[model samples]
Target: MKALVTTEDSGFGLRMADVPEPEPRPGQALVEVRAVAVNRGELSMMAMLPPGSQLGWDIAGTVLRPAADGSGPAAGTRVTGLADGAGWSELAAADTARLTPVPDDLDWTAATAIPVVGLTALYALRHAGLLLGRTVLVTGAGGGVGRMAVQLAAASGARVVAWVGSAERAKGLRELGAAAVSTYDAEETGPVDVLVDSVGGQVLNRAYRLVVPGGKVIVYGNTTRSELNLPVDWGHARPGVQLRYVHLFHELPAHPVTRDLGFLVQRVADGLLDPQVATVAPWTDAEPALRALAQRQVNGKVVLTI
Candidate 1:
């Protein structure tokens, strides 16, 4: 199997080489890689660690085999979801309990887009009680998770007011179902029932005053700031209104876990969701895409064609 291997622990090394195929462990599934996407987590990981670590998380592929522990995807099936690492490879392993089935009609590019970003959006919208025609504002509305949230919340009957940093994205955000699209400005203000924040720091701090009383704020990823900040008093003084940080990985497998990646896969299999691929590059070109994406030059998800 050929894989993107990190040769050093620091942020700047990646080499493609032949590695042994991974065998499925009990409770795990083996996937023949098709497509994978990039995220800031991967960038930061590479920056912080030595090379030799496989760097990838979002993946969509087919189940070649499931572990003998009854983890098979009914033997073979098209599926997608989060993975531990080694995503930039021809093969990978994930717990059978974590893999989700993709829609038969969807391509791997689209299938690969939904899991991490989709789940984050799902959790945010649900936590905010998105229905009832509530007005919600999503920061970074044209990005991966933001676009999904915009579409998902709009589909659920929410009147959405979204913000993006660039004017070019405003039109698309509107097309995707934002009731209103505004250029993110610190002084801007509007009443909202929920705010799904992916871009943080100043944008997040400014968003504090926008939600209605008793409303909730869901914080997931921080794209704009490495050292994110919030006004403790921002949401504190408003009784019944609270702010909570939600990481999909942490919440996806919470205790008494009745739901997992399979839930997201079910939605995908049912045609309720799709991942938007911003760009697809071979593993050799991953670095430039990762750099551009990490720098915000790329919108939506970046997939690696294995």
Candidate 2:
């Protein structure tokens, strides 16, 4: 099978290579990957991967075989889920517990775009204890996770404030249910009951200060990759405010990832949640697709069709 693997070169650090197909374990299913979504997190760690290492995590495909333990959906079921590795390949062995059935009418690209980001947004909101009538602020609102976060939070009856880098990117956030959309540099005069910060650095610092007392700030991705410098007196000023860092991989076991993913999939099927796809390119065009993501040229998820 051909997969996008790590290369020795700098800049995106990926190349197509033929690799052995994955073998399903007792609780895993072998999937014939139809499409894969590109994420900024995977691209950021590309240079750190050993040469020829398989990349990508989110994928949508048909199950060629069911789990040996007979714990999941049957063979031939179309599903979308996360894989530990080699998700960019034509085949992947996914844990049956984490897989969610994709709706028959959903496009493979759209389905592939949901897993990682959708789960992240859901988990973050849950961590923040978001409630109806609460004001929730989502940073990097134009990105995949941010867009999902905005929609999910709004659907939960929370007032959603979307923060993006540019007005152009903020164009459709309101339609996603965001009560307000503003640039990252804009001042947030009102306090929010919960905050989801994906774009660490100054934006995160600003978001931290916007949280109301006893509210939580869930820090997930650090797209800016810069150090977060909070005020020296923050602890005294916001004594009960909780600061939590969310890493989906670490929280997968404790949380019902598959169940939550399934619910999100259903929402997408019902047109309640949109996995806004910025680009859908052939698998052979992985290089350009990855380059677009690395350069932050895409507004939402980028799916590469196999």
| Candidate 1 segments whose C-alpha is farther than 4 A from its true place | 8-12, 186-189, 226-237, 255-274
lDDT of each model, Cα atoms only? 0.75, 0.87
Candidate 2 on 96-129: residue-level lDDT in tens?
Answer: 8889998899889889999999999998888876
Per-residue CA lDDT of model 1 for 193-260, tens digit only, reads 78888778888877867766788888887776656665676656666987788887787665222154
lDDT of 1 at 272: 59
User: Model 1 reaches what TM-score against the true structure?
Assistant: 0.88
Instruction: Give the winner by lDDT.
Output: 2
Clashes of 1: 13
Whole-structure CA lDDT of model 2: 0.87
